[model samples]
Target: MNASAKRLVFLLLPVLATGCARTAVEPAMSRPDFVRGEPRVTVHRDHDDLLSAGLGLAGLAGTPVPFADPAHPTAPELRRRAIQASWKGIADLGPLGGYGQAYGAVPAVPGREYQAFAWVPGARQPHRVLLQVPDGFDQAKRCLVVTASSGSRGIYGAIALAGAWGLPRGCAVAYTDKGAGSGFFDYADDSGVALDGRRARRGEAELEFTPPPLSAGAGVAVKHLHSGDNPEADWGRHVLQAARFGLAMLDRAYPEQAPFTPQNTHIIATGLSNGGGAVLQAAGLDDAHLLAGVVALEPNVQLAGQGRPFYDYATEAAIWLPCALTDASFDATPFARAPMTRGWPQRCASLHAQGLLTAATPAAQAAQAYEHLRAAGWTDNAMQVAATTTAFDLWRAITAGYASAYLRRDAAHMPCGFRYAGMKADGQPGVADTATRAAWWSDSAGIPPGNGIGLLGGTDASTDPTLAGERCLRALWDGDGADSRALRAGIDATAARLPRTDLPLWVVHGADDGLLPTAFTSEPYVAWLRAEGRRPLYWKVPHAQHFDAFLPLPGFGERHLPLLPYGYAALDRLWAHLYEGAPWPTQSSTPKGQPRGARSLTPAMLGLGAN
Candidate 1:
């Protein structure tokens, strides 16, 4: 980023800012109000109503209003219990890597403390596990809950969730690092358990690995899915092993204190995204009833075998993404909107000259483009940056289209980025480009966790990629090539293969989920469950984006999105039903507290306009 990048930003920021400037109220649905469709489900405000009352996405400023009954256990009481819990051994667990690019260092939870433990499946070196237990946590009343780390920042995901939700509930919680989040494992390494933690140039940083104080023998090889590369096992073997080990440790260490017994105490696997999928995989694969239930929050496709399927690597890399890049508008028909007009022509030309993009016919061009890009210099880093840019452009277009359709705003409110922001700038909103100033790079180099690279994992796109990619979808819909078969097999392998059991499973998705769309992530699993007659519970929250329930809303600074409170309540109900024979909680309310009931999920039912 030289003078040209600055000039480009100046020219583009105004246009991009236009997308955020339109203040008109758009219809919550994707379609027009006049369109006849299923009745929108009404949601009830049970235990999570306070979230909408000024809690920001970070939930930093305000104390969470006490949602629990005075008689029932409260978060504050549970937190107090956690604070007083015993701390026998503390070790240097080392640092979890930061998210790449513009995202800042992963924040440390105030109460979370790392414990030395050798549990993860693969490794020559020991891995530490983070554990927190409620003060009154007992085996008879409270079950040990193991959460999976979702993003590549490894343990950061665990820290965030545990601090925000789990530990507050007074239950025992634990998580181990999934190697993939840190980009530690080498795909090219053939020794099976090969991992390189040495720091290197821009795209390659040495991962930190501190062994547990006590040797747990040579660690097992983390499975493919957990690595977050090649999508092998849904949550990966490392997560599964770590989860099981966490449970076993809970049973052994807290047996007298709580129902941490293997046969009696219930263990639940829970998490978001990859962690969510890992729980599902654990439930399916653990034949010994290691985990009694699963609460999967918008799991990745590899875990559930759901969503709009991709065939080959080429399809995922090429046509699927390029279609969105070419979209001129965000209408239902996804017509090529502005590839040539926006900036793809010039960008593609530059890439072509650099041997990154080649001239090819329109037939199955995605694969061709992928080959060229890979042949040139597109590593995981480059591809992630490109994907983030494409996703942002597409989300803006879609948001503008919905606004224009319902609020009378023009769709072209923003200009796309001129160059791949690359390692210089993360796609996260508000991050400054370090490439523009060498001093800026040096200034951020000493930051924590990732030294400045925050939790901007690949899946955590600055914008959504669920919608576009029609060309790739259409092309691969009936695909039957060797690559397709291999890809499908890999996906299928990651899913739970054991016969469906009595273990309970619950899934929740926000209609306005911006990170991963319900149609692509959860719908397929819901359909499969229905077909299998598994009787799993699923909820779709209207006007709720990806972070609404889990993360505070960034747009509305201090106001919480509130969906997660409901999700937590639902989890409680699910737990009670499974463990205590209590009936499942059933109540619904709209964002306005209007009474409502669950309805079939449809494109119209989804709150596309809310994002």
Candidate 2:
């Protein structure tokens, strides 16, 4: 940045802080470069609010808003359900889970929302960006938060995480789907999700994603899995564009604050999961001093010298984690019910037949599998807790999509004969029902095995159907084939080298996070950054794991801590450091015991000062 950029931190408060007031003269602000065409602007007011889609905290905690018609739902209905679903997916929102009382409160904030398609210069399809500027936004604070979707979710993916934290603070929030969204394309009907959240024909309106032409009965296509963009490589740039979009949209909404530039605004980049990875990526690319600080929690990150890559570990889990989970000790984990774990022995059997497990009995094989995983950096907590993600078949579902994404393959060319679609009674790939299709925009997590879309492979359980595909995925990661080379290349592209910077930086991780293990992501990430001379505060919370929503089971909840409260606290800590120069704690919490039952969580349990 030039002297002009660095000198404006204290120069524009009087002229640019009055949000939403029109100016007599036209502003010199220009639209962000990646933004394509005109954006669809919606002004939320009176009854409808930005934070909860008018549902407030109480409404969000209750049942979802019913769609008048299941076959063809309205856009507003989709938006409301999307908000509720996004919230429930990220946090433990039940009364006992400490949603309303412990940390978060949903207040009504009328705001203007901007939704538009943003093109990555050489991408096949455009990613989506959304900007929400509350009517009561304090421009003098000049705070803006930009985040990416946590999983391969839609634009509202991080609403429950970053948006929940920032919007309540009167800060403008910018979100991007990061080229991975809940846009499903059904080849049979030639229909897809439109920009407005409606189901439309391929050429109707502006479709969010249109799969390459497929055979008549081909499966459903997801943007993240089938876009052929390998989008993770561009996650950082997507966040930067989202930040720019937020600033530009702020100028449009509050012309009195025209020309909202990075210099004058305190831009804070933050997120969770993949969204967390996105913010970290953006920080590395912020050579212009654009971002003032960053907070990433349990981010699925892979740095030059960090732990194992997501694809490598995910596929590894998909293959052997099942056999390991068959150990009787894991039966108490979340989703590890009898019906769910009944097939674990079968997976172990398959592993045994393939000579992967040398034990003769399933019990012995399971123990051997456990020992194998233990030697491969699988923590004791992660192995036990991962029973949840494994039972959900998330490992296979996640890896198949990532394999396709990392290889930049189209739907027709997905590896290991893996694909996604609704399943028939007989378990064959079939078209999704009208009711299922109607709710996809609001329900799908931008991944299959969700929103009624199932992964189509050889055969589920009884046959250890996903094993072959998972093995194929791992082969691509370890073999010497062309596909293997291509897959590794894409993973390399997503690698980060977050350089040392003076910006306020913080990273928090759940010590028991099984999905993106702490061993593979944050510990080494913080260590690498420190070695490079960056003094980022690192917090590793014990008793906490990824996926707070999955803590419904008594054993899971009792044994684990929710990750949200800590993340929110870190954000507060960052805010105070930015404004009050408060001391930032560099040490981990002293492993506190949590009051995890319903209505049991409190500020003291979280180690925050007091309520």
Scored by lDDT, the top model is 2
Residues 104-159, model 1: lDDT tens digits: 11222222122333433333333334454443355455665776665333333443
Query: What stretches of model 2 exceed 4 Å from their correct place?
Result: 1-29, 424-428, 458-462, 583-599
For each candidate, what is the lDDT?
A: 0.36, 0.79
Q: Count the backbone clashes (under 3 Å) in each candidate.
A: 31, 2
Candidate 1, overall lDDT? 0.36
Off by over 4 Å in 1: 1-128, 136-140, 183-240, 251-255, 303-307, 310-489, 498-500, 547-563, 578-580, 585-611
Local lDDT at 426 for model 1:
51
The alpha-carbon RMSD values of the candidates against the true structure, listed in the order shown, are: 18.6, 8.5
